[model samples]
Target: MEVDEEENNDSISEEEEDSDREPNPKHCFITNLPDQLLLLILSFLPILDAINTSFLSTRWRYLWTLTTNLDFDQRLIVSPTEDFSKSRRLFASFVDRALLLHEGSEINRLRIWFNYDHELYESHLSSWIRFAILRNVKELDLQLEREWEDNDFYFWDMPFLFNPSVFIRDSVRVLKLCLPGLDPTPDMRFGSITTLHLKQIGLTERTIPDLLNFCPHLENLVLDHVGLYMAPLKIYSVKLKTLSIVNSIQMNGSVEIDAPNLLSFTCIRYLADDYLIKDVSSLVEAVIIFSLSNAFFQNWRKIVNALTHVRSLKVQSWWWMQHLQQTGEYSEEILPHKFRYLELETVLSKMELPGIARILRISPNLETMVLESDMVDQMVYMADNNASEESYTGDYLEKVFTGSPLYLKKLKITSFLATDNEIELVKYLLKYGVALEKIILVPYKTGLVSVSPEHLAERFQELQAFPRSSKDAEILLL
Candidate 1:
């Protein structure tokens, strides 16, 4: 009887243990996915992260090498406190190993970004370029930031020179380079390239014109922080549709553009340089941003007159308002062109009201208006002029828009602080904008101030109290 009881107790314990154990899960469905789909998933990840997926299982060990899009950024490998020389060596070694192990015959895109020292890594850089060209890369981006910024450039001594014949394969369609200098060879012709972005490169007067001849199919060109050899840089591309020049240096003389097929033009420069958009009859959009200077006001007028055909215009020039106040020359000349959209980035103060009024009068067909306040310059003019808190005199717009039709249907104000002056301006617009349908108010986003719930509620109530001239008008706070 005792032996029977011991056996039954042991059997009960075994049953309990069995019931507590969970069943094995089914095989992972993702592991069974097709190789092409897996490669596509890996392509979206950073190159380092993609490589890390190799450690997951034996099936993924070499799969990363088959990815067609590879971006090797040195910032991924080196920590901020790492030794510079050691980090460079580590980065270079990894790139070489990765490229050697890559199995793709044709790369869809390849980007390499690093702080380049010509004396130490010129050979490595040259080999990388050759490797991309040999692999039939469709889009290649090389952003080799030079270590030395003060050194003078010599054309023949340009770093990372490759065989001019290697690039004639007509495979690369988009090429972006941010090198100290570019090697211009007579035989260099990119027949398949459609878009080219060159940044921080030194170009001479003859370099660009000569380079354009090489890229027969190029349609988009961007020059950023590019220092020119002399003044009067002439760009005459027949097939080019978009052109942008930002933060360019040494272009003191006029930049004459004659791209007949151009559709969009953007110029953001600090210097008070002049530009002539000749033969660009197809231009429909223009963005011009310049710093305040005595010579910029005249250039602003010329650029606006030249862009008469543009239906959309966005300009940021605080000097225009300041200059107008000092001179008090309110010309009543209406532009021959009519703009459908106008965006102004300036300080919305008492002194700038007339300037804003002038723009509204000129744009008779304007349907949309966007006012973006430059917060940095917002207080400069106000304090300098010793302006009062109530800047809007209620009749400023009416006086300026007299006889000029107010066709504005939509309005947007960004960097709104909901101050007394700003509230007055909103009130004035609401009272006068008879055809207004909606108004958007976007609070300033400097990341320094946070609005309390109470403050937000108060602001909402205040906006609701303002009477609107248009019964259909809606006020939205964003």
Candidate 2:
């Protein structure tokens, strides 16, 4: 009878069979692959996609639960049109069930990004964090967005403090919390975390030091868009290596930093009336970019003095020259330490010529010089109608020109427009750069337009005709 059935099946044409028939597992190469390989392939997919593999077959149903990474987002699971209550219930249920079903003993990373009322899900979030801690999660990232009650904004403190188990974990090495209230208790200790990143949070003087004390082993700290309340914010840590304060709003006072082991300090648009830095002797590099001119005069000298040990400095202070002229702070006594490499982010106009020359005179050992044009600064400089349009006249050039040989070997001009001031700056450098060997000119580009080829050719020829202090000097226009 089996032979008769087999013979009948063989006799039927290929098109006569059901087209929607499920293929045999043995014939499906993907399904037949080793479970380890299949799980590895699933690891690259999003959490939802990885979980959807359970519907494929019984083998894959339990495999996804063993994955090391469980990244859950409420936005990815809940439909916007659904009822708020229903959506919240579904998301909560999904996270709870997923964590319960996870069979892995150790999770590499656990990320939960939820946008809901903290009061409603506080217990649930605490449970999830505890689960992560129990599983020895290495990288724990929690980004919770608090929902306002009546169109009013309020900071929701980290709710896991109720259960000290989550805060006392030693498995988490990298911790990232965004838009959460982070007020660590005096007894809490995050001793294992090496990198701590807090974004869009509010911090006070006490909380800042408390965080540093709690995370004793923290090496890299980043405060992005954080609002500081207390004046004269002081940050002191012995083990901190890299500190980045990006766009942090500080109140009326200054910032005092004392990190003896610090290696790199990056400040971008961080405004403070003054900076009092001490014992940063190990700092190798410092990048300070100020988009506002309010605090440059009061803060620049202190920052520069602290960065005397740095081999490289990248600064964007468009108003330094004007401030120096008004305050008479452009002498070697102000910036006594020299840097090996200097990168200035400013428009090569007469407004910045004196500052540039002063910096050059101080950094007599500078081997590389970069002149970069920051579009925002350029726009601000141009919009000020009261700003004097001082020409690059003989008197102006003569005042800045130090009759000394320059140690600059390589010069780079970015966003070059061949303006009269820009050309004069290039000529001034060429005239004094006795050790100059190479100069690279990058034309300014706007949308689809760039410096015309004919214009570039004319400028290149003109530059070649100018006098050179270095006989082996070469120019490149790109």
> Which candidate's TM-score is highest?
1
Which regions of candidate 2 are displaced past 4 Å?
1-102, 145-165, 327-329, 398-402, 442-478
The local lDDT score (0 to 100) that residue 454 gets in candidate 1 is 70
Tell me the lDDT of model 2 at 197.
87
Clashing pairs in 1: none
Predicted structure 1, TM vs. truth:
0.85
Give the Cα error of residue 92 in candidate 1, in Å: 1.2
Supply candidate 1's per-residue lDDT for 355: 67
lDDT of 1 by residue, 1-478 (tens): 1112233233223233433333333424654689999999888876777876654555566788899999988877555455667667666766776787788888989899887776688778777878898899999898876555465533223655434455665899999888775666787789899998988777776877877899998899998878774456889999999998898765556678899999998888734366676887899888887755545677766766688788887886365465555555455342324778888887676666666767665666888989987756556646765756454345754576455336578989887777665675567667767788988988777775565657656776787888877888788888
Q: After superposition, which runs of candidate 1 have C-alpha atoms over 4 Å from their true positions?
A: 1-29, 148-166, 270-273, 317-319, 326-337, 377-398, 401-405, 448-453
**CA-only RMSD, every prediction:** 10.8, 8.8
Cα TM-score per model: 0.85, 0.76
lDDT of 2 by residue, 274-296 (tens): 78898898898888877645447
